[model samples]
Target: MLRYSLMRLGIFAGCFLALWGLVYVGALPRGLGDSNLLWVLLLSLVISAPLSFVLLRKQRDSMSVEIVEKVDRAKGRLQDNRTREDAV
Candidate 1:
């Protein structure tokens, strides 16, 4: 899960930096006046969301599996404890 999260963050950071460069080079339009940074950040987020969804699909699936395994383990432990208590 952490791996997937970090990968997602990496993608966002990459998008942000690339967009920032484009804006700096005047290849991309900048936001009006004081909103320049805000504009770039929002645009980066919008671009990164779909990229992460497509690029990180495997990582996301593995994270989900990890979570399911943990939940199943916890449930099994709870059932074991309950049976032990009943036997006492």
Candidate 2:
């Protein structure tokens, strides 16, 4: 999970930097007046979301499986405690 999170953040940062560079180079139009930074940030997030979804599919699936396993273990523990209480 931590690995997947860091990878997603890395993708977002990469997109942000690349977009900023493009704006700096005047290749992409800047947002009106004071909104250029906001524009770049929002656009990078939009671009990075789809990229992370596609690129991190395997990691995401593994994370989901890990979560489900943990939940199952917790439920088992709870049921065991309940059974012990009933037998007391």
Which candidate gets the maximum lDDT versus the true structure? 2
Estimate candidate 2's alpha-carbon lDDT, on a 0 to 1 scale. Answer: 0.99
**Candidate 1, 10-86: lDDT as tens digits:** 99999999999999999999989899999999999999999999999999998999999999999999999999999
**Positional deviation of 32 in candidate 1, in angstroms?**
1.9
For candidate 1, list the clashing residue pairs, or say none: none
Q: Candidate 2 residues 1-88, lDDT tens each?
A: 8999999999999999999999999999999999999999999999999999999999999999999999999999999999999999
In model 1, where do residues sit more than 4 Å from their true spots? Answer: none
TM-score against truth, every candidate: 0.93, 0.97
Among all windows of 10 consecutive residues in model 1, the one with the lowest summed lDDT is 1-10
